[model samples]
Target chain A: MILYLMCFALFLVGVYGLLTKRDLIKLILSIAVMGYAVNLFLILFAYKKDAGIPILLEGVVQGSMVDPLPQALVLTSIVIELGTTALLVALAIRLVQKYKTFDITKIRRLFG
Target chain B: MPVETWLYFTLGFMILGSIIALEIKDILSSIVAIGVVGLGVSVAFLFLQAPDLAIVQFLFEIFAMIILVRAFVKKDYHAETPARVNGFLVAISMLVIIAIFVSSISVFKLLPPFGQPLFETAQHYVDHGVRETGAVNLVTAIILDYRAYDTLGEVTVLFTAILGTITILRIRNGKNAGRKGA
Candidate 1:
């Protein structure tokens, strides 16, 4: 319960950074931080106390194994995060190339 | 150590790392701090009993760090954006946090407790996974067999992202060549 709130606070930190940061790279990094915080929160949903791994070892007692579904979901999400981050950084690079700076305030062609 | 204790500690580490990453003016410090946050979250995943996720996270963190480093090589070390502290931004942020807090409290009341019953789909796969899919790991069977379509979609997403990146970057290269030729 408390852990979930902590994750939420972490997410808000990312959000605050996103809203406040004027640098393109910093914005990109903030988005990534938000993604990580969400992933951690999702992992909490499937956690079980005294749980073992979700593998099917031969003759191994399958007692209270942690839920594997969220793990699977998170696996795909992590890869997706990589893709999005790359795309954002690529866009940021192009922005810098065009504007000669990383500051969003200076890259005002799109704003007005 | 108690599980709660570990969870709290991991969360604290992650919060601290992220704050540092976002708050710092130095670009290099921001990158390193974000990596620390990533590793801290990976550790939290481990404590949450998801070794596969931890591994994937650790690997992906490496990938992100490598790309970021490459990107940073040509870019300046310091963020030149001046910090702004407008009341509107602060108000919106406070409102969002409050909304999240309220909604989360209500949602927690409606949902089942920490341990949900075994999902029948997962249970079926777990019990007969080895015999049916010939994969000793149930997670492998679940991903490769039971949810093969989902995996295919994930692969498609990766391909699309890669294609987009190549197209975008290739344009810049083409423009550079045109300049050189001119």
Candidate 2:
């Protein structure tokens, strides 16, 4: 309840930053923040009360294991995030070379 | 408290941290904040019992941070002026919309309990997945065999993105080359 609200708020804050911020780096950070918020929401979706670790070992009780699917998805998403960040940074570098300043307002060579 | 409660708390913290990251003004600070957000999300994945996801996320964060840092080092750091907008109204409207959407969804009752037919089906695949698909990882079996076309599309998208990025970043040959050719 409260947790979900918090997540939503966080996501909104990131969105606001991404939309309003002129700095390319801040925009990237906002996007990353949004990604993290979504990931957190997904993980929260899988949680179960009193669920034990998913691993099955000797003498371990059955029927109390947590869901493993979300974890796997999160791992993949993390990798994807890494790739995105790398690409974004590469683009930012190129943009910087073309334009001397990091101020995005001054680097508006591609305005529609 | 139950593990679920703790997980929820962690999620809350992650959300808070992400919000802060987004709002920060400094570029380097924002990058670091984003990295922290990624770490928090990875931790959340661990709590969800997705060890594989956690591992992948950890690796991704490292690569992303490195790339961002490199870019910052290669470029000049400057503060950007804030864009003007009706922030209060937008925030209010967005919050209202989100509240309505979330409340309508009823996520609590959307999915059935664990070990349902879906799990049984997934488990069946896990049991004999390797025999049919020759893949050790059950997730891989589902991804590669069951969703082969989807995977192909994804690969195509990746290739396209790479090509686009390269094209966008291509450097033009200077007047020296032109003079030499003349």
Candidate 3:
């Protein structure tokens, strides 16, 4: 489907940035982008046509709900992404402090 | 507009924002652009019938933006790293990899087409999850009850990350702290 391919494109965009970008902050953002793409893909998988949210409510048919398992898994993943972003940012700050530059290429200690 | 239309719009917005974020020279602009992508994803979550995820995503976007902004404040605003590898070569290689990936996936037909989910396990949860777990929201039930151990592990990972961040920031540089006679 178009959605799946678009999601894959989003993921590839992240990969391209990760591979090509040199700034530490850009690398962090690329990682976050990849996380978003993956989370969206999982949510897309859980969707059902015309299904309500997966909360049991009065007068609402239980069967007419989207899958909840992936939602729960994605919740965990989102939190994990947050923690990862925080840690990466913290590491970036320390690297900046030690090396005096955001460019990874400039951070090398032993120059030929 | 229909929900699908709006969803597509948001997805396109996210893709555009990500591209802008990466291509822009200004670090602050890049951060704000990625924030837009995150907010658009939160909106997509709502359209996809996941309010809980929407809320979490909204909160996450706010927090992530705050952290990134705080970290970047008063720091170098513009950084342009010249490409060490040829841009054209990277592009061609990526295209080849993507083509291979797409062809393999299409030949295999790995995923069920968009709307049709394989819900064999989910059916049991939807039927008896509320009665068994006493949680109206099946997602909450699964997270808090059925997968409590997993939740515990998630919390532990978060805690460790925060603790590491604090430890990394708190320690003084070895050079700054004069060493005692060895």
lDDT of each: 0.79, 0.62, 0.86
Worst ten in a row by lDDT for model 2 chain B: B113-122
TM-scores, chain A, per candidate: 0.94, 0.90, 0.93
Report the lDDT tens digits of candidate 2 across residue range B1-182. 64557656776666666666666666667677777777776776666665666777777788778777766844556445556656786677667757865774476345554223134334455445557877655555555686567556656655665665566556443533344210
Q: List the residue pairs that clash in candidate 2.
A: A71-B50, A75-B53
Candidate ranking under TM-score, highest first, comes to: 3, 1, 2
Residue-wise lDDT of candidate 1 within B74-178, one digit each (tens)? Answer: 456555456565678778877887787778776665645554533445666666777898986666777788888998999899888888876666665444676
Q: Give candidate 1 regions above 4 Å deviation.
A: B115-121, B173-175, B178-182
Model 3: residues with Cα > 4 Å off, grouped in runs: A59-63, A110-112, B81-85, B100-110, B178-182
lDDT, residue B54, candidate 3: 98
Worst 10 residues of 1 chain B by lDDT: B173-182
Q: Return whichever of 1 and 2 wins on TM-score.
A: 1
- Candidate 1: C-alpha RMSD after superposition: 2.8
Docking class of 3: medium
Sorted by lDDT, highest first, which candidate order results? 3, 1, 2
Q: Is the docking of candidate 1 incorrect, acceptable, medium or high quality?
A: medium
Model 2 error, position A99 (Å): 3.7
Residues B1-182 of candidate 3: C-alpha lDDT, one tens digit per residue? 76667777888889899989988988888999999999989999999999999999999999999999888756665555554756786787588758865785674367887778876688888888978999999999999999999999999999999998888877667686663311
Q: Taking the candidates in order, what DockQ does each have?
A: 0.64, 0.36, 0.69
Candidate 2 fraction of reference contacts recovered: 0.36
